[model samples]
Target: MFIESFLILLALNFLSAGGVNRPEERIVGGGPIEIEQAPWQVSFQIRGHHICGGSIYNADTIITAAHCFFLSGAWQDPRHYEIRAGSKSIKSNGILVKVAAVKVHEYYVHKENQFFVLQNDIAVVRLSERLQFTNKVQPIPLAESNPEPGTMSFATGWGNMYGADAGDANKIPIHLQGVKLRIQSPNFCVRFHGQSKICAGDSKHTICTHDSGGPLVINRQLVGVTSGRGPNCDRPATFSSVPYHREWILNAVKSFPQHV
Candidate 1:
C-alpha cells in the first residue's frame, strides 16, 4: 500500500510539472483586438511559441517585464527569443525579428512564497534589425507622469483568459486581446507593491499568466508594464510603472550597440 501511495504521489508531481511548462493563453475578460488598434503590441516568443507581451519602444527597442527572461533563478539567452510584431494573431500575419540583446533591470528580484513577489520587473530588448514602420506597427510614447487614481487605462496581451479555478483544457485565443482597467490610488498600491508599481483592474478584468510585460496604456501613452497578479488572479493586477523607470529605459536604449 505504501508503494502504491508513493507511485500516485509521483504521478501527481509529474502532472504538476507538465502544467508549469504549458504555454498560457489570453487576458481574462478581454476581447480580441485588431493589430492596428494597438500597433505597438508585440508577442515575445521563445523559439516559435508565444510566451509574453511587449511594446515597441522604437524601431529596434522593445520593452517588457524583466521576469520574462529570468526563470528558475537564471536569465534566458537572448538568442532564444524573437519578437512577433505588426500582427493581431500570434499564429500569423506578423514580422518576427531576432533578438540582438536583452537588458533586464539590475535590481530586479523574484521571490517565491504563498504569493510571488516581483520587484523592478522591467526589461529592454534590442532587436537584431530595425522594424519597418506601418500603420499596423509603431512605437508607443512612454508616460511622463503618473495618472491620477480612477483614471481609465487599457492593457493588452495574449495571456490566460480564465482564473486559477478554471480547467486547463480551455481553448487558447489566437488574436491579441485587451481589457479596460482603472488606476487605483497610489497609497493603496504602494502599501503592497512599493512605489515602483501601479495597481489597476478589477475582479472582473484582471490580467493573468502570459500577460507579463504587456503594456498598460492611458491615452495612447505607455504607463505600465504588466508585472503580476494575486495567487487566484482575482485581485487588481500590478504593473511596473513606466514613469518611475523612464530614465533607466532611456539609458538602456542608448547603451545598446548603435550598429545592431
Candidate 2:
C-alpha cells in the first residue's frame, strides 16, 4: 500500500492574452502522433494564470485532475480564461473558451484519504462556449468504450523539469511527457487494493508528480486521469487508476454539469 499526503497544486503554464506558452513537440517511443493533436491538448488556468495541461473530449468539456482544483487556495469561481488546444506553444492561439463550470467527483477526498482518491480524481469542466474542432484541436477518444489495459499509452503535461514538487508557477509550451507503462495485475494494485485502478510505469522509471490531472491515454483514448502517488511522488512508480465511479463520470458527462 502507498502512503497519502496533501494533494498539491503545481503550475506548468499560464494562459496569456495572446494564448498559452508552449515548448517543442516530442513523441513517446517514436510512435506516430496526429498533426492535429494540438487542437485537443489543453492547459488549465487558475484565475487566467497557472497552467496545468489537459485534453478536450466533447465540444463542451475538458478532462483533468481534480487535485488541481482541490489544492488551489486561489480560484473561487469559474471564469473566462482561455482553453488553448491546438497550439504547440502555450502562447500560440488555439481554441480559447471560458470556464463555465466544474463537476468534480463528489466523493473526491484529497488530503485525508491518500491511498484512494475517493470518487476518483476525475473532473469535468464545461466551457463557456463550444470549441471549434480543427485538425489539431479535436477530442481524443474515451476509454468508456473499453478502457484498455496492458496497451501502449501516452501522457502529456507541463509540470516540472525534474526533482521537484507537483505544482510549479510557470507554464511552458504544451509539451508531451511520454512514457510506456503496462496495466499490471489488478490484484497487484497496492494500497487498499488498487483493483479498480490500472498500474502503469516501470518500477524503475517513468513515474508521475505534477502530471496529476493529466491523461493516461492508450490507443489515443483517455483511460485515466493522473490521480497522484500511491505512496509518495518520488516512488519511481506511481499509479493513475481509473475510478470505479463510472456512473459519476458518465452521468455527469452525459448531462454536462458545472464546476469551478
**Every model's TM-score:** 0.87, 0.70
What is the C-alpha lDDT profile of model 2 across 119-215, one tens digit per residue? 3556778888777777877887666633445565565654443433333333222444455566554444443435445555543333343455666
lDDT of 1 by residue, 1-260 (tens): 57435433332222122121111224777799999989999998764566678999999999998877765445667776789999998878879999999999999977655446678889999999999999999999999888888999999987767654222535345788899999997555323665688888877887776677889999999999998775555667788999999999999999998963
lDDT for residue 7 in candidate 1, whole number 0-100: 36
lDDT of each: 0.77, 0.51
Please list all clashing residue pairs in model 1, or write none if there are none: 25-159, 25-160, 26-159
List CA RMSD, all candidates. 6.6, 8.6
Worst lDDT window (10 residues) for model 2?
15-24
Q: Which runs in model 2 stand beyond 4 Å of their true positions?
A: 1-39, 72-75, 80-82, 112-119, 145-150, 166-174, 186-190, 207-209, 230-243, 257-260
Candidate 2: residue 111 Cα off by (Å): 2.3
Q: Determine which window of 10 residues in candidate 1 has minimal summed lDDT.
A: 15-24
